[model samples]
Target: MNVAFDKPSPWQRIQPVFQGFDLPLVFIVAFLCGLGLVNMYSVGFDNGSRFFDQARNMLLAAGVLFLVAQVPPQRLMALAVPVYTVGVLLLVATALFGLTKKGATRWLNLGLVIQPSEVMKIAAPLMLAWWFQRREGQLRPLDFAVACGLLLVPVALVLKQPDLGTSLLVLSSGLYVIFFAGLNWRLILPVLLAGAIGITLIVSYQGDLCQPGVKWVGLHDYQKNRVCTLLDPTTDPLGKGFHIIQGMIAIGSGGVTGKGFMQGTQTHLEFIPERTTDFVFAAYSEEHGLVGNLLLMAGFLALIFRGLVIAAQAPTLFSRLLAGSLSLSFFTYAFVNMGMVSGILPVVGVPLPFISYGGTAMVTLGLALGMLMSIAKSRGLMQR
Candidate 1:
């Protein structure tokens, strides 16, 4: 029997790693990644090693995705509470003794710089999903209230870090989980109505409110400036408004069919600020135009739609809630990034997913995608 034994091929050895993968999700992500690489090369070739660095980041993210996808949803539930606890602790530590940059203390140094808020992006949803799962059928309003308390603690910590973008992402991720766990719409609609009224009031009284030293009570000085700038960028055409004005110029110049690929003068000539990072969508628009924007949006919609489908088909309550929240978080990221670039929303530090060059955000995105895939795979296995 020991005479002639043949070893399995390399493909066979690694096959189990991808045994129950979701094809549509894989294809959609691959399409977006291809677009990202092309855009990076075109927009970042002159920005030193940005193009290469981004490629490396994407590769690292891919490795993270594969590793995370292999973890079953049950295992993920087991890790949620601990991950959430650690993330909140890190945020607290950051507030007490963190590295400050540009007037915000958002990063921690534990041999390496890390943003604890990014961890909450996934951990918040995971923790919430796991919470509801424990109370599966015997859910009470008190259960929902307790879940809100768990979510608000981390959210408040991140906000105190004054990292508004990361805080919003964390808040929304947890809210999505709560909503999925069946919080009453009666509670949600009133908040939405109040927000609408607040926005209307802000716009109507912008002139009086935005005057120098008026001092909005809750917001920081810079935060007030961002909102005021968004209301009417022309008020500070050269100083605070430069980013928005330049971004609008680049986007509008793209026209119907765009300036064509690497031929974008606004992008190539360096008119768009942060062309390789936060304002990447502006650079992309300058090169690809409206047609490109539509296609890009279509890709995002496909990703969101597919993710929701997986959530609906998820075999467990935890999987369902986690998948749904992560799916909508993608919407929040894309909507806020694009809205800011297009001059419709206040500019914060949110990045255009797959299109922007951020190692941390890319890894966070990979983890979210991996969770989606894990849930999808679990659903398939259950059916089988």
Candidate 2:
């Protein structure tokens, strides 16, 4: 009575794969990718390669999402420590003896130029989720301290590399996990208050701090310039502030219904800097207008909502924590990128998630979506 089963037919094998996938999330991601393609084509008219590379990145990301979706949450948990350890060690290696370019040492050379900081974006949250999962019932203050230590090491290293953007991203990802794990409100409020106070101080002292040759404490000269320029872009109108000024002008010119498609004069006239990358949003807003912006926001909110639903349905603490953190981190990525492009926040080189033309960020987002799909898939497997 122990006869071996035969292989499933091609259709039979393919049917379950599609059925197991999270269709709503799939639709949301597809819509965003399609929007990205349109925007890339429109903004990258001067150089079509960005449009092509963005397409390639989307394909690579899809493959990653599909493959990762096949794995169960429990199995993914097993990878937490190993992946995090490797990612951090690589970061340390990057800090000690790594490649330097453009006055920043964030890259590594292993026969190829690679950025190690990018990997921590996912690894930090995964590792923290696993740690919290293990100490679910017996969590203590010291556990939070250890968790903070785990989160800070790579963040500190990335800071040493002086990559404010990636470090902030990584830090936010880890903090999402920490926040989701029942962290006390008392501990969170002080940080928020301090941040508010710091912003106020910076704005008030803008005139004094922004003077030429005045260096900021614990921040690079260029970094301080960015903050000061954000306070008042007219301070360096044609130089450091050009990008922000041009971006805001482009955004404001869009009006209610935008300039329509490729008719954005600012984009075509080359006023917006890095139209295909960090400042792509301005180009998008200039073309798509308010209605288009609302649609895009809706798409992101839909995706985030689905992610939170998946987190709620997750079967384990680790899965729940990871899913929630990934979801919020996705939100943070979009918020900061859009805020930066709109001249409301300092430009820290964060891409606009799926819309921005970059391989590493797309891959990271794919991995996160794949994890969400995997968690959803795990819930299905349990019900069966």
Candidate 3:
């Protein structure tokens, strides 16, 4: 019954794995990963498997990091179109024969349940970056329009699936590629102004305008309810408004120093909904308080800033566009999730990047970081 304990040779053990290392990108990912572990611990204490699952996810992410790091940025660019095409086909399949949950069809089944929209998150950026690379020195209005078309196709499909959060993420990621490709600010300024005006109009006349059959054409009923809930959580405190009210209460109850880890009354009392998933932020806030929240935000900011620096230093247009879009996409994920949980934004199901608990999201984020690492490592190699 003796087990083989003999260790393999050093090269056999390490050569395939550690053949190439991107130090800066690896450090940034490891730091964010450490923060995710802490946040998961805070929210997942009573849930026996979540902590272990998170650890397993981290290992899987590291493996992704290694695999993607080995690929050159040019290779990723070359794979962009076929990858994006496959992703779109999957999205179409999801719409046709997908699994529906909570009234939305967002996942496809091929022996395993998978979310096709997550693939678009990566594909959108990759595809746009590839487009920009082709038109690098000759980027023109038509090229920008084509890039927009690339973004709009997947975004429209996702939005049709009625997954607003993911649709926005995909849209924003593609827009980041456009911005990085030297888009005209004159064109962007008008859109921003119009958006601000639209927000003002919505908030000003929300009561009458949102009272069913309003002029707003795109928003779904549940989406409208979430916005209304954000405006005034007390509107239906015990029904559709329960999530925001409880989340705010949990966050406020944390006070200055917090109730300490695993000691949060609201969380342990089971008042917070989605405690281990989208609203994990509220649980973390309740346990860690303002000080802890600030620390968490600071860690996120550091990661984003480092990512942008990597993007800025990337040698090629494709690498820069890909890195920049991925970096900003991370920012969007944090902002949207925190804003929703804090009642400042509509409740769209955007996970808080690495911190929130979900296997698909964690893997998508790992893939993004791997892209950034690929860009960073390429730049490092070029400089040498």
Query: Clash pairs of candidate 3?
Result: none
Candidate 3: Cα lDDT at 312: 87
Q: Rank the candidates by lDDT, best first.
A: 1, 2, 3
Off by over 4 Å in 1: 1-9
Computed on alpha carbons, the lDDT of every model, listed in order, comes to 0.93, 0.92, 0.87
lDDT of 1: 0.93
Output the lDDT of residue 248, model 1: 97
Off by over 4 Å in 3: 1-20, 213-215
List model 2 lDDT by residue over 1-384, tens digit each. Answer: 799999988999788776678889999999999999999999999997988999999999999999999888999999999999999999989988998889999989989888999899999999999999999999999999899999999999998889998989999999999999989999999999999999999888878878889888889888998898899999779999999999999999998899998899999999999999999999999999988899899999999899999999988999999999999888988999999989899999899988999998899999999999999999888878
Best by TM-score: 1
- Return the clash pairs for model 1, or none: none
Worst lDDT 10-window in candidate 2 = 13-22
- What residue pairs clash in candidate 2, if any at all? none
Would you estimate the TM-scores of all the predictions? 0.97, 0.96, 0.94
Model 1 residue 293 CA deviation in Å: 0.4
The alpha-carbon lDDT assigned to residue 304 of candidate 2 equals 89
- Model 3 local distance difference test score: 0.87
- Comparing candidate 1 with candidate 3, which one achieves the higher TM-score? 1
lDDT of 1 by residue, 1-384 (tens): 469778999999998788889999999999998899899999996876888888899999988888899999999999998999999899999999999998899999999999999999999999999999999999999999999999999989988889888888999999999999999999999999999999999999999989989998778889999999999999999999999999999999999889998998988888888999989999999889999999999999999999999999999999999999999999999999999988999999899999999899999999999999999889989999
